[model samples]
Target: MRKVLWIILGCTIASIGVLILRHSHVVTGGTAGLSLSLSYALPLSFAVIFFLINIPFYLFSFFQMGWKFTATTIGSVSLLSLLTSLDHLLPSFTLPSLMGAVTGGLIAGLGLSILFMNGASLGGANILALFAQRKFGWDPGKVNFSFDFLVVLSSMYSIGFSKGIFSVMSIAITGFVISYFKQKIALHNQPTPASVTQPLDNAISK
Candidate 1:
């Protein structure tokens, strides 16, 4: 129940943050950025673009991250898509580029953190990052940042150079936020020493 609540909150927050970025005419990274970029060129909505882009990654997560993670992620992504669509029904307003960058970054960071901590994800590069962290001992946050960097660079053509720069600011802040929590979670999950988990007698004998 707690996990479900957290995942829902995460999706809501993420969808709002993405909407803010879109309305500001800016972009971020990962599948979100890709979806945003494509949405600008294509007539399709961001929700549809986002959901479609993540389909391939869903398969990756299912095979590498297991069914439970993939299932939760699929649910999270689907809900986020639905929530972001609601933005169209609301009073339309555009945030300034700078304000959108900072605010969206913070909100996205928080939402991504919540989703990750709860064992859910937005798929795409997120799935790859987590897999690398577990299987290769890499820093998931840095991996995410690297992927986001490439995505932003590739998307500069679509969003224009100036907006891409702002997008960089957004992703950088989001990366920092994710790295902070990733470190804490990694430390928390480290193996406990025998002396800590074992009885004194057992420890001394061992």
Candidate 2:
């Protein structure tokens, strides 16, 4: 029952995020931001574009992040896509860039936090981050930041440098919040290695 509730909540948050993006006419972060850019230039739907961009990353996630994580990501991605499609039926709103960026970041970050707590991801550069962790043990957040920088750079050429800069800032804020929650959850799950190793060292000396 608890799992079911969490799943429902996750879906709801994901949908609300889609609505936020649609209503605001702004891009969020992650693969979704790239998708938004492509959708703006092309005729593709946001969900379809997102799915296509994400499919290749699935193999990386499957091998590095494991099945449970991959499955949750797939489900969340699907939910986000459906919400994007459904959102087209509703009336859209016009929001200014600054308001859109901040609101989009907050909603999208909160939704991603719920997804992360459930052991999943949105699966774009995030998949790239997992691969980096597997190969070099690099911090996933750092890897994500590097890729986000690339995405925002492209946004500068495609849109304008100012919007791209704002998007970068918004993403930075969102990523920081999500990383903080993730670290807190990780600490809650187990003792820090420094503490555990100290006890072991004392035992060995004794």
lDDT of 2: 0.64
**Local distance difference test, per candidate?**
0.79, 0.64
Tell me how far the alpha carbon of residue 175 in candidate 1 is from the true structure, in angstroms, after superposition.
0.8
Tens-digit lDDT string for candidate 1 (7-38):
89889988878888878877768987777778
lDDT of 2 at 164: 74
Every candidate's CA RMSD: 6.5, 7.1
Cα deviation in Å at residue 17, candidate 2? 3.3
- Model 2: how far residue 124 lies from native, Å: 1.3
- The positional error of residue 15 in candidate 1, measured at the CA in angstroms, is 1.7
Determine the C-alpha RMSD for candidate 1 after optimal superposition of all C-alphas. Answer: 6.5
Which prediction has the highest TM-score against the true structure?
Answer: 1
Q: State in Å the error of residue 116, model 2.
A: 1.0
Q: Which of the numbered candidates is closest to the native, going by highest lDDT?
A: 1
lDDT of 2 by residue, 1-206 (tens): 55445545656776675566446554466787788778888999977887788878988788767787789778767666666677667775766677766776666666665555545567898666545544565555566767777777766776677777767766675666556555432322222465543332233233
Residue 81 displacement (Å), model 1 = 0.4
TM-score of predicted model 1?
0.83
